[model samples]
Target: MADNLPPPSPSTSTHHDSTTKVTDMDIDSLVHCASYLTLHDISNMVLSCKFLNRVVYSDTIWRRLYREQWPEQEPYIISQTSCASAREAYLGRYTDLQRFKFVDPLVYDVHMGIGAKCSDLMFSNNSILFSQGPVIKILSIDKLLEGKTSIVSLNDHRARITCMRLFPLKETSLFRNKAQRNESVLVTSSSDHSIRLWWKGSCQRCFRGHNGPVTILSDKLLGDGTGKVFASGGEDSTVRLWSMSSGGKRGGQHALKATLYGHEKPLVLMSVVKHKASLLASVSKDSKVRVWDTTISSDRSSCCVGMTCVPGVPVGIKCHDSLLYIAAGSSFVAVDLRTMKTAFKTSTRNQPKLFSFDILPSKFLACTGGVGRAMLWDIRRSTGTGDADPMAELDGHVGPVTHLHMDSYKVVSGGREDPYVSIWDADTGNQTNILRSSSNLNLDGGGCGCCGMAADGFRIVTAAYNGEECVVNFRDFNNAVFYGAFSDNVTGSKFWCPSTSGHDHAGDESDV
Candidate 1:
């Protein structure tokens, strides 16, 4: 009792002094607490007092922030360190991403007004080439930056443009001189029963074999972007393979390599898959699906390898690892390539009328159904099951969702009646963003002519009705980082390279 009473009285002066000296706390203690603060809070703290400046600039704090911002890139980002190199690395990465500013809506908007509606679009070498009626318009990305609507118009097709593809040049030609072999070459199909090859905005050759209007065109179908060999399907009930040997030096024109004839009705081209044997898959209005072998030798004519006759029109087709996934009527059927037999079928009784389908890298199928509904089916979980409920159903558009474009993180869908583009989280099926134009559109289906969008991890390009096109910036969408360099190898994007960086220094854009 005596020791306890004496202990407090002896240190009374020291304890009182310590309590009064709170304002003079050491820098380490304050900085460790600041570590829990956000970057903006720390930034304010730096300006609050000279003593806190050092604390805010600590390498440890910045390293934590960097890791928090780009967790997937930690293995590559946090490996290198510096005695005084925290903010420099982070700032460098930030500035390096300035070129990839498409995800930022505040940056800029490109508005172009043409007389006709845009049907399809493709990007190449910072230039946009799209179809409108019987014409194709070419606009440079630089021109868009300057708010210019002046475009190089290519008018040749006699009727409406059906589809177009900008295929890349051969590897040898591309590596030799990319500027010369730029995506200036285009293949277009039209309702005029002609497939024309264009070079530098001029028709180089005309393929005039299809008896009926050519509706679809495919490039790089054989897993090579050479733009040398391509296939076209038309209302003539046939599929034709066309090839331009390297530079087409033989006749300086495309040659008809093979013509596949099997489908009982007019062909509706879906997709081409190259496996042990190259296949050209197309569906018809009569619900007949045909897969033609394009890998036959020159001496042997190409023939139909497999066929599937359904009751309703097949909407779409996708191939992964030799397995064919078809969305027809109210079910998605998986066909084995080896046996050409039905491997499994999953029905969507609750959500019928499957129009278009896309298979995610994770084997999840995202299909657009009746009335602007996009449903996701986990094939691994739903395979061989009958009428399994979808994993998630996303509804946003006011009208029928006609087209869907998806990456690992997001899904961008457009509808027949809605003028807006809805972006959704692919995993959670939650609507993340809705982008619309300022112009008022009055029609049954505005921006419904084309619903698909193209993304380069930064910007999304989409075509709409009334001759309108929207380029949405997706830069900071959900704090997306340039993780394409560090994504998992199983996602089929292991070799994806960032195309929007402005600076590069030994692969580290940061000066530090």
Candidate 2:
């Protein structure tokens, strides 16, 4: 059999002797083999020759090859192969297929009071804040865990409350003559077309300006101490800035610092970059993302950076350092502010309706949509040629996922399903926990509609459609403790809950 076998090919003989010059072998063959190898294997093969490394690391070729094979049925190697023989020959050489694992669920739940639909939920420190109908309720998990019941209801708003934010109180020598830090306050916007400022036990003041419902409120303190201001975006297609002062007096009232007008459609979300307090970004239903310069004089309206526009009806917008991330109809796009251009765009494989997204401090984005799924994207590596694939898909909710919250290592998503809250490991995509609101606690004949996770990554708060709110803490997931609940009294529409922190009430916590 050895004698009958065909003679060794020239390519095979070329590598037999240490002194043999392999330069005469076909370069195309070597290039083809290198393309089929795994990134790890390719690195080893490149050590065999300088030419191999040069070809393998060529940005143009690898980028083109990567774009052609992502999120598809074909293996990257097979996609690069032009001939059936080459594909068949190389398929066996590369056997490592990326695998994803789903882990056991985290167990916890929150009981609802009076069975109502909850629209939004938020978590902070040891407390959870949620809204149902027009009312926002604050629950202290520490108090609940200790079996000491105490729920604070802030329902002073005349109309349905749409969004709530905890503003942080920063001490300034000018404001505090005795150098005492002021107590933090809660800033809330509502469909009633007003913004209310609340302190520990009272609704301090209400600012009226927007003609329509207030959608989002984002505030940041500017400068070290002298001047501090905040911004609020509304469905009225207007963004306003307010100056913080000592009292609720008209003299210290919210100053219409700057009016941002350009969104032809409703503005859905707003985020302020802490490093650049003058820089503010908003996403709107008009399929556009706008960046504004809020530092401009109040007399001069803020202008939008139309040049860096992201196409699509943006449902979510987040900014960190030099990057701007936007979520539109099943896709997310990242733009570099330095270049004022889109760097990468990736599909979420779902529609954009009734979805909410949150980006953790580590550049991980968690998005939930009507598909009843929450997906996490590792955006740090998504640049240059193509977008990064989703690190993991979280599937547990039976209804559309409405809201998502994530920290450095974990994710919490809420939807209208049996399990109201689903938690996951941010890196591994493993299901860390399933927090189910008690069926007996069902409100408005539906499950929790939207939810929020704590900044510390330990608590989840959810709201039902019928006007009910619930909070759950992950620390006691195995025992599945039910923290607390609140009832809404207005339109019976769902309300949003924001995590309760001294900063949330004071507007000092970094925006997500």
Best by lDDT: 1
Per-residue alpha-carbon lDDT of candidate 2 for residues 1-512, written as tens digits (9 for 90 to 100): 88999988988775655564556556666566556666567667568778666665544344333434332312233333333333222221121111101111132355555544554555655666766667777777777777665678788777777777765555221234433254356778888888877655567666777768888887455434556666777888887777666454443354555677877776777778656777777777676677777666644443665435555556677778887777776677777776777777776544444366677745555454547677776666555433345777787677777667666556667765544566666666776445444323444455434444443423334443434445333333211111111111111101111122222221111121
Give stretches of model 2 more than 4 Å off. Answer: 1-112, 171-183, 219-224, 251-254, 305-308, 350-354, 361-370, 384-388, 442-455, 464-512
Instruction: Write down the TM-score of every candidate.
Output: 0.67, 0.64
Q: By how many angstroms RMSD does model 2 differ from the true structure?
A: 19.4
Error of 1 at 128 (Å): 2.5
Off by over 4 Å in 1: 1-115, 171-184, 223-228, 246-254, 297-302, 362-365, 437-452, 466-512
Q: Candidate 1 clashing pairs?
A: 102-473, 102-474, 103-473, 103-474, 103-475, 447-465
* lDDT against the true structure, each candidate: 0.61, 0.56
Best by TM-score: 1
Please report the TM-score between candidate 2 and the true structure. 0.64
